[model samples]
Target chain A: MSRLFRLYEKKRGGRRTGSKTVGSFGEALFFGIFFVVGCGTMAYMLVALAWPEWRANRQFEETTCVLVGKRVGSKETAEGEPVQFRPEFALKYEAAGRAREADGVYDVTNLYSSDEAGVKSVIEQFEVGKKYPCWYDPLDPQRVVLVRGYSLWLYVSLLIPLSFIVIGGGRMIYELAHWNASEERRSVLDSAAAVDWFEAEAGERHFPNVPDGSNQTNSPGTKLAYRLPISATFGWTLFAAMAACILWNALVAGFVVMVVRDIALGEPDWVMALTLLPFAAGGVWLIVYFSRQILVATGVGPTRLEISDHPLVPGMPYEVFLSQAGRLNMRSLEVWLACDERATYHQGTDTRTEIRRVYEYRCFVREDFEIPQGLPFESRCQVQVPEGAMHSFLAIYNEVSWKLIVRGHVKGRPKFEREFQIVVHPALAGQLVS
Target chain B: MMDPRLSLMLDEPQRTFRPGELLAGQFFLEGVRPEEIRAVEVSVLWHTEGKGDEDMAVHFFERIDPDLDDVVDLRQPRRLSTVLPNSPLSYHGQIVKIRWCVRVRAFFWHGKELAAEVPFQLGAVPRPQEAPV
Candidate 1:
């Protein structure tokens, strides 16, 4: 069982020290339990509810039976519960060259009603000593029913347990496939190998570790070879904020409606009402916050950055064009060439990522910058990659990246920073410095 | 009889090489019967290590099935080689490190498997220290 699904595997580096940690086995177990229970209950419900309907309609023998007597029968369902009534009849039929007498129920569902009048109305459809068509179990002539069909309520109720099965089974399979498997194992399964079958080809002068820069280099620039793509645009941020605000308020509105309905019934739920106050306040704050973001995004207009070359190398100089369009007064505007190191780690079950700026060089700085409504601010800055700067590195859990940032402080408005990502290739051997 | 053992050896004693340099290695099995071998897999790869999940990329890979090849011998040493790429030099950082290794795994017909690895350095990049904030 451990081989099939590992609850704990030997930690990679910790193997030498003989340490262990909880593995995907724990996750698989959790989902596996849900899968088993859901399937069991669903199977039981299907066999109990659907099997009889199917048998009555498709497999049971249809025959004519004389209703000797019909009456509205009542039975106590449970303690303190009202009595339930159903239409029943004494059935007489001939099957397999033999006469049989049986008590006939109205339907396979055995549905009962609290009102005796409803049951009497159903029995009125048939008269005593009249022949009526009914279905009898072929294997047992004594088992019979007056009606045969599916119950919509029972079938619809299956969806609840079905959802659990889908979620649990799907996640269980995924966890089993990825549990403790290394990246190479995954790549192998994906058939990502490109080298020669026997060995790596000679003189293959490619930097496989360097990230591709085609995303930034695809668009042609008016004055340069490539236009660097912004990491995050103000418009996208504003849209995300607006979406969050709408979704949050929509959820809060549902709870408020529930509370208001309870109050209208004169049985107000004070605990629920008190719990909704903080959520209602949060929705109001989100609305206000999103409104301010909208104003700033509209006032900021757009920012564009273009670079002369891509896949930059250390000890190289490049030209960058910066443009800002808006009607705004700025205290200062600065462009910085920066490199950041990022690492992601797991703490218990929580995953977190931390980033730190490892290198930064001032490219251009201007004071008392202003932009008129019709006139846009445009400038070019000469940026140099630091000689000893580490090239951009990317792995599953760590990364080193370079970027160009534009910081603008608008008078009487919040300062905004726009970032443009760039890739840096490994420096030449001679350029390396200690 | 001694337990089955797998040994891996790098051509370079120091196991250090520059980017775009050739990396060669070999592996041998001992205390294992030849008929018990099912297949062998060899790879030169780099993987990340530290506080986070490890990521790996294979530079070269090959598999040999002794049952399919009439001339293949599981008892003899097998050679493997590859040319390293010019980026992602072996790094020893505060939170993350990249390590290069030549790994050989052998599958036995009895449902047992053995693995051996020899670590090597890809570049001479100095260990990095966090810059003062």
Candidate 2:
């Protein structure tokens, strides 16, 4: 177990997690077994089906056989299971200048079925004492077959082991490639995402980790160069709540049906009815929660933010246009420029993520505002990315991001917050104030 | 047997550099015969450390194989140079720290390996402190 943990740690980029030893060992053991079973099954299939099929087609010699007898042969598959039937024919053929008699097989892979009638239909194909073309093993004349074709089951059975091999072998190779790899080496090996791209035409480095601002830039703003997209629209949250409510109530309905049926039969299961009380209450709570989400979704309106220029750099001033649409009285509406650093790490068997706000600046704030229907509250503000601040950074398990947050406290409604993501680039040496 | 000695040297004495500046270095191998050397890889890269899983990117990389480049002696100092990238300049954060380094790795006979790296500061970005709630 210790050895497996050591191997797993190396494969995990050498990050030592002593607390997660047991979990890592279990994962390692599962993959190890999966790989071994895959290889073993593949070897078994090669010997049982593939090799014999190849020999039957290549090494067996064609001969003529006279069918002397036919019968529905039944063999017990296992204890407590029904017997399976296969058609068998007594064949007499001449091989190696000698007459030999043997039982003829159907194909390279034998077919067995629980339906005896199906086996009888196959046996009825040929008449007794009739000479039919057959193939005989050159090495063993006793082994003869009337049919020498591949079975459909042969291909179907191979898919099972092949699936195992693909999954197991692919995982093993991935782990081995990452073994003892440095951070840079592993990053290069992560072929799913390219690390970075250097622009030869403009002599600039494009960091792949930074979120692309093309979507925000493509839509030209009415007052600014670009309109920033809102992160996480409320419609999705409402939809998710509705889905959960439906699923939970549907499950509770099943239990209700069972309890009602028991009561109708005059055998009320009090224990079962008592056990379902909490779940029934949970279903009711979900419906109420979903209804509240719907109300919230309908009440809140669209919020828009436009920036004068995209791909903002530190220490530079830029113009921002904000628009809020709704028929409501707001106590306060504020827009904040914020940067957060997020980190993810494994703790025992669980993964925990932490985010810290490293910097925040209030770009715009309005107190005690009102907006009537068909009219939106609009304002413009000037904001600057702080100097010596970290630009937007992203890695597999860490991220530093910048965003504009709009917070509103409306009278007689729940407080709301909306975020618009933004990208910040590193300031050039000349741009950084001393 | 004792392991072979590997060393890396950078041209900048203080090991501090700004973005878009030329970062030049070289590596040397000692106490091992040249015939026993298989290959040498020198790279200039930056990687993240601290609480999260490390992430890295290679600004430049070069591999010197004794068999492929026949005339080269393994012990001779080989030059490594590249213009550093502009972004991701060596940040030291609370839960995550981005670091830049030049690494030299040597593969010897019998599947033995040795590596050395020299750390450097990039872009003079001050350490960030978390904003109070």
Candidate 3:
């Protein structure tokens, strides 16, 4: 016994549970279907493999026989597309001291060919006037076939169903010896859940072992606060965007350079124009896209959020400061404080995170300015936090997040939006004051 | 007939509490052998249970591993104490449910274990302005 199966058997005891054919309902259903069909096919092939000899030896007599005549004919295949040629033959044989003859082969389902050439060649080998070993049933000596030997083709045909048997039987056996029944597992901690599984790095780092009866909580700022007008998630994404632009520009530019050099060398093909067309178009698009992105990032000089206090108190009016620099015809410039509740759950094969806007405090900068191209703008606003609102929280699958949302529109430019992660603690006496 | 089960009770019966308050509880045993028991553990835990899979955090743990050779009163109730955490509290949200509970687990030899949970509310409970100072 393998180590895994031995361990399972020891746990399961010698007594079996559930179905005898399978471990689970689905597996049992599968076994019932595949096992029956696979066993049936395999049995047929095995009988077909041994049937020629089995039939020759049982209730049959052997005698001298001659291939009296033979003919070749074409017939449609099962699919009706390909045509196959079958060989019909007449055999003369003697059994019970009586002369007898039979036409065609008995119970023959094997002789098939996609091309006529193969069956034609077999007919030439089995000449019309040739004597060959044959067999006749003692009860019906007239029922005779001139050829009675095992076929190599039947041996090869067994591989089809044999594969099914190996796979289905193996699944049934493995399912019967099923392991991994423990509800708690070592892999559960890998999900970065809020568990005391010393297995997670963050869990280990945040919650540590101190002597029992200690009143000290985790040291202040052990976890770096998520600063907002922009989230850390956006920084990596912008970096990746820039990196992709550079990589693509370099590749297309190199190809263009190579093509230009080849043309200058007087060996250019006109078909190169077709290949270079997409590269040129992509080159133009990248230039435009990157320019807009860079202008939004650097030209805006980082959207800043100034909260009146570190942990904003519920029902408290907190001052918020916002600023941005750009040349724009402002359709809308607004700063919004928002709280979103997110739930992460698995649906089928996908792990989905659904976010719902639970609260919002939108404040628009009332000042209008017409500074053109490369200038600065700043504003201040206050929004009241609703009392009894859920505080910012983060658990394994659930999160209540507070963020600063910034939106602006520059004239003839794309609308810009950015979000910054911030913390909002539940109103405690001393916690609201930073 | 002596019972083999262990029951749990809170020291203070208030269902709601401010974060960082002391959450204290106790576990009473009826008919369990202290010497035969491997360990009795009490933990301050918060877990999510719902459409989202459950996630647990053990904020505090107190364990009693009694010497099997020594004689002790199995009826002596085990006391448990821990400070509540600040961030995650008792929350019932759509698709996710967060619950804070004190759990007591008793372990015996040969793959035998029993656990009981007593849930409590923690986090920001809105107090009326004129309630108190």
Candidate 4:
């Protein structure tokens, strides 16, 4: 019983490197669905093949019959009304040397045309008093047909469901035969190799104002004077999802159009259009929602962080300024200096950055303010670089930085957050010289 | 057996120098013939070492082989001098450390070599404790 439900096999060596079961639940379920659907469809094909052969080879008496009636008809389906002209073939025939009368069509398949002219053309060939060939089985004289042939459409319909069975069953067999835990160990080695490669590639990163051989490590191209816990303005993930939804809806709509065209040709496939209505409506809503988020994030202004002197030396005091303009409507405004340690590494297909704050010092705060409408405000403050602090520096995979953070709250519109980067160099002069 | 038998040392009392200061050093060879001693070179340079990637730069370098061809012993030492550059003061930090040094290398007759390094402090001065920041 324990072996039957086991999930992990005993490891022969260092790592857990063996399979505990013959097949996963998914593999079993897929194979079961495959056989159930595949066998059912194959049974239908077999019946179609056998029934035609039986009727053709059976001893049936051949006789002549006279056509008696014909007309057009209409029916209702899920998509729309399917108007087709159907011929009700009435005929008179004899069997077992006895005179008898019969009235019915030979073709059991309900083949209909959208136009009345199609049925008219077929019925016109057989006049009301004309004689046509008929076949009646001797064992059952009442079982007679004007036509005796196989239905090709019954075999054609197997193509769609058969494809699903092949895919599901093939995947299940492959999983049971060759699936193992080797890929798990390979991924571990791959991750370490990728990290080393990313470090080497990142070493060539060029920033603004950084001289080629200068003793200084600060790059002039560091755009933001500060770093944030989250980059709230980038909505790229949601935007990509919106794009995928639009593409899918386009494909589905194109399929519906083709199906609608076939319904016009008497296929009666209006149910397809009805099935697509909900997905089309939901796609429009998703497009609107994601577009709004993207526009607002890109369009809004970030409360700015300004420094009096960038690359200031330690043991020196510097001025910091914060400003915002045009309809802020903020409930709170604040600015602070923060020291951060950032580490970057590669994980699978993604490059991840981790940030931890070493310290923070608030420089200004304005929780309550009564500014007139259409007014802009600027605030100035001072922050001193500590004497023995570590200077701003960047390595391939590690960084030590100082940045100013600005935060603002508003009842309406997006809450504002921004950061500005600053570099602090060690102070010059030894104790004896001073 | 062909390795150079030489000793190099800085002549300054404190073994320290500041920006724009002229650096001076000396080296003595042990019973080496003039034909055996091929060349002598001296350089003032700075290099970084620590958790981060290391980088180095040469502020001054001179090969004295072409101008002088003479042997020297402990009684009469060869002289080396160079003026220093500004910036990049010798710094000691939590994750990185940079040091300034004068290096001497003597070239012998048959692919032989001897080298020595004399480190010195460079900066205005260390800041005092309890000073306002």
Taking all chains together, each candidate's TM-score versus the true structure is: 0.67, 0.75, 0.50, 0.40
Candidate 2 CAPRI-style tier: acceptable
**Ten-residue region with minimum lDDT total, candidate 3 chain B:** B124-133
Give per-residue CA lDDT, model 4, range A326-405, as digits (tens).
Answer: 45456788787766655554444567666756557777888756444456567777877665554555545445667667
| Candidate 2 lDDT over residue span A326-428, tens digit each | 8978899999999888988776678888988777889889999798898999999997887777888877888998999988888877778888889988888
Tell me, by lDDT, which candidate is best.
Answer: 2
Name the regions of candidate 3 deviating beyond 4 angstroms: A1-235, A249-287, A298-302, A340-358, A365-369, A372-375, A394-399, A429-434, B1-3, B11-14, B49-55, B68-72, B93-97, B124-133
Task: Name the better of 1 and 3 by DockQ.
Answer: 1
TM-score of chain B in each prediction: 0.91, 0.92, 0.81, 0.78
lDDT of 3 at A421: 63
Question: In candidate 1, what are the lDDT values of residues B15-109, reduced to their tens digit?
Answer: 99988888987788899988889878888888877755666777787878788877676567878788778878787765667888888888888
**Alpha carbon lDDT of each predicted model:** 0.79, 0.80, 0.63, 0.60
Q: What lDDT tens digits, residue by residue, belong to model 4 across residues B1-133? A: 4534777788786977765678887877765666666666677776655443444555566555632744343325878887665445665543445678887776676756667788997754343222232
- Model 2 chain A weakest lDDT span, ten residues long: A194-203
Using DockQ as the measure, which candidate wins? 2
- CA displacement after TM-score superposition, residue B58 of candidate 3 (Å): 2.0
Residue-by-residue lDDT tens digits, candidate 3, A1-434: 34223322111321322432223546756765676778899887666545645676564666777887887766755675888777778888777886777776533343566767877787887777778877676666666655566666677777877777778877765554442221122123223333655444544332122111111112222122212335666566567777877888888888888888888999886687678888888877877777777777776555655555555556677666666655666666788777776777665568888886656667665434454566556667776556655566666666767777887766567767888666555666463433
lDDT pick, better of 2 and 3: 2
